[model samples]
Target: MTVRGPNLRLEGSTFGPRKISAWREAVAPFWDVEIRKEDSSEFRGRSDVYHLGNAIIGLTAASELRNERSRSLVARMGVDHVAAQIRLEGHATVEIAGREVPMAPGDISLLDLAQPLSLRSSGYRAMTVIIPRALFPEAGTRLGAAHGTVLRGATPYGMLVNNHLRSLAAHVPHFTPAEARAAGQATAILISGAAGLGVESAAERPLQRAPVFLAIRSHIDAEIASADLSVEQICRRFGVSRSGLYRLFAPLGGVAEYIRRRRLARACRDLVEGGDRAARISEIAYRYGYGSPAGFTTAFRAEFGLSPADVKAGARPDGASAVRRAPTDLPGGGWDDFYEWVLTLDA
Candidate 1:
């Protein structure tokens, strides 16, 4: 099959007994999956996957599959993504973080990839969205206890989210890169709101810091090119106190560190995938507000353990290089933009 644009479709009947192995390999990048079958020959399964810029959505149907995340597997994989499963047909149950959740048609439940999860399903079909943990900082507290919280599709928010996912799936192929990014942002915002993370409108008078933090973070991202970007400017712009800003960013290692890290990350992406062969390293550095090329190179080396030139060189398949280039075929703005969108969910 000619795979294009991060999309994939797989069927188990094509592989016979090796079907289990095929399934494991297909999802190994995202999850550690296992299955139990009374007779291996009778096993049947199919999966359709769509990569939605920041997240991956898959529609899967299988005959009696079980996923048991072992301690050894968890230690080896270090998985850091979360999967939100929306049941479309049949039934399934998930056990995670000392909580058990059951699902019927039109019901959704969340599973944290970091924790151990045991799922059992029989003749099941579902839509699963796999999202990075960093994309939902506002839902951090709730996500800690999100394992067993089931959202019924009959509710208003549930209906909205479910319908949106269906529509997104139907129209994913037609979306431009920019539209995909916007849809991904909308997905995160809707999930945050559904999880009660204060993603409602500002007119609703949300007193939580999540919304305010999102706004302030959006402002910072927009103004990152400005050399004068500072905590005081952020405070004045957002009407937040210096102390409040510090407290909000304390967990992220302070506001300045966050900005620096974001800048370096963007520079790294540009060096590898910016598609401007003649663009000088110094120009990219200055674009992100670095005072000097030397300073930018030093910081980039410290963060990525390689020089900017090494990173750029790694993208080409020549001789051995200091670093291996990871895949950069993602639509939209990649990880940096995804993080910005996550922080600005309410925006």
Candidate 2:
């Protein structure tokens, strides 16, 4: 069945010191949102603030959002939910199903909201479609399996899914009540097909079996920068035996090593794009669990084939270069469709 509604609108300002906290409290019900501001005040701290809205679709970027409050989401325990995102520009990091999924421009990330999840954007703009557990089709099972998974242009399904989202987002404002319903149905069909559910019912995959690895991975990702973060801590938090944790990483090359690789990857990104007044390599390395510069440098060299310094000196790749586009073309569609879409670009 299709559903239709008028385009939504949301507006909040930082007129007073209390504006940030006011916004945070406002957005808490819709999604877990955070804001980190340079200004330190009673109302707006260095934490997240939420702005309430009835699922919006709009675009934002650059000078328009410099003093902006960062937004973050962590879906607490629940049965299951769906988020269809289309990456219009910039990038996003979403923790799901035990992995850190990155979304770049022109990509799509289908997210399951039932499981605990977190999302962060580095000055990103996109379209997101958030739907209740009941509205989703049977294909949600496979879509769950694909959570925390990054789908880029390399996959046909990924391309098609992204294109469909783009189309839906573009027309969200003009859809008639009847057309809106049809749009929802089409979105579900495409998402189901793109997720490889085929003709088999979504029931083929059970909801009770949400990916346990996601919780494990999410914890690890958050602690990656912490020198004290460890697999043992992960084990304790999830109540999984050490051996179970070891097995989880056996396919990738063991837990400790995996964390190292992931951390180094993050450090590489930071160094290259960190710009002026960026943290030093030593600091980056230490932050990512490296004890010494020598150790961190060795790993960085091996993986990226370039010193962190060299990468920082090099310019951002031409294609990945970020430019502020009109809010209309911002990935994931405009704010009107923001909460309903999942962004999975690879930037």
Candidate 3:
């Protein structure tokens, strides 16, 4: 199988007002791009976008500019999707409903297309994944209110998502149709989990415990290295009753199950990457709070369907080849494809 991508490509590399006009034409569907008259001479921009039938991913970079989706524009185009972005090289401020959200490099943010927002940025590069609202109906009310929410890249959840989005963008081309669809669904689920960090909408009033729920997850992730990490300690630290904690984690298989999965997940990464130091199997187990090598091995294989030694030897649990890239005969979608991809995504 050959790898192919970048279904839609847009770039303006020349000096002139018309070049800027062309750039705006490319971005007109999703956002209105604005650049000062004189600054047009120095303007440069480019975006390569891909479609996976279930999601749209884009890699974009442009000179300093302002982008907006007015309330009128929101009504004109009824695209209901959520865009999750990771800033790669520059910073910006997103203004939504009069509130300003400052974005920095490595930070991830969510934007609900149904809502209007304006973003002003210095020349920047970014990677974005756009998912249809239909897939996340569970978070609809919460997500509609999550516009302009930011997840700091320094946080545990943020780092995991940050790395996954980047890796997913690069690996999309090699994905088979089935693999791409599965990945798209998995990406949507992963993002909904992270959406817990998003701002809750007062109008929805559905996420009463969202903040506390997010805090507990963060605390668990930070303390995963300690074998003694337990529900009793968590309750004391967060000042929540044991039943409250259980209720918060019920959707994720309870707190203890969450912690166990997290520990094994971290250990699996260590085995696969081998990091700066190739730790022994027993050491990896102990480092992740596993009591014995045998126990860790059994748990890891049960969760991932692969043994620790298999992972160390470079066997991917997902069955995708590690380094597979070749030119493919993929459709080179013209400008119209961008509009079609976002507007009729589920089709």
TM-score per candidate:
0.55, 0.45, 0.61
Model 3 bad stretches (over 4 Å): 1-3, 137-139, 198-330
Let me know the TM-score candidate 3 reaches against the reference structure. 0.61
Off by over 4 Å in 1: 1-6, 12-15, 137-141, 197-325, 330-347
Candidate 3 lDDT over residue span 1-347, tens digit each: 42366777887457567767777766676887779877878888888887776888889998899988765344334466888889998998887656677888988888877556788889999998889866764744456546677877878888888888888888988887777777778888777777767442212322246556556765776787886689999999999999888876653456777777767766765675564466999998888877899999998888778898888877855311222222123446566456556656762
lDDT of each: 0.61, 0.50, 0.72
1-347 per-residue lDDT for model 2 (tens digits): 22222323333444434665444443333454554454324222222111112122333331111121111122111223466667677777766333565667876666655334556665555666654433446535456555444557446777777777777666665565456556666666676665553321212232333345545555766777886688778878788788877765443456776677667756765775577867988888778877898898887777656677777777432111122322232222323232222222100
lDDT computed for candidate 1: 0.61
Ranking by TM-score: 3, 1, 2
Query: lDDT value for candidate 2?
Result: 0.50
Instruction: State how far residue 8 of model 1 sits from its true place (Å).
Output: 2.2
lDDT by residue for model 1 (1-347), tens: 11233356677336347876676655543445656556466677788765655666678888777766543333223334566778888887766534466777887776655345677787888888767656775544345334445677787777888898788777777777667667767776666566663321102122136556555655766777777788888988888898888766553456777677667755665676654473688998898888889999998777656787777765421111122233345432322232232222221
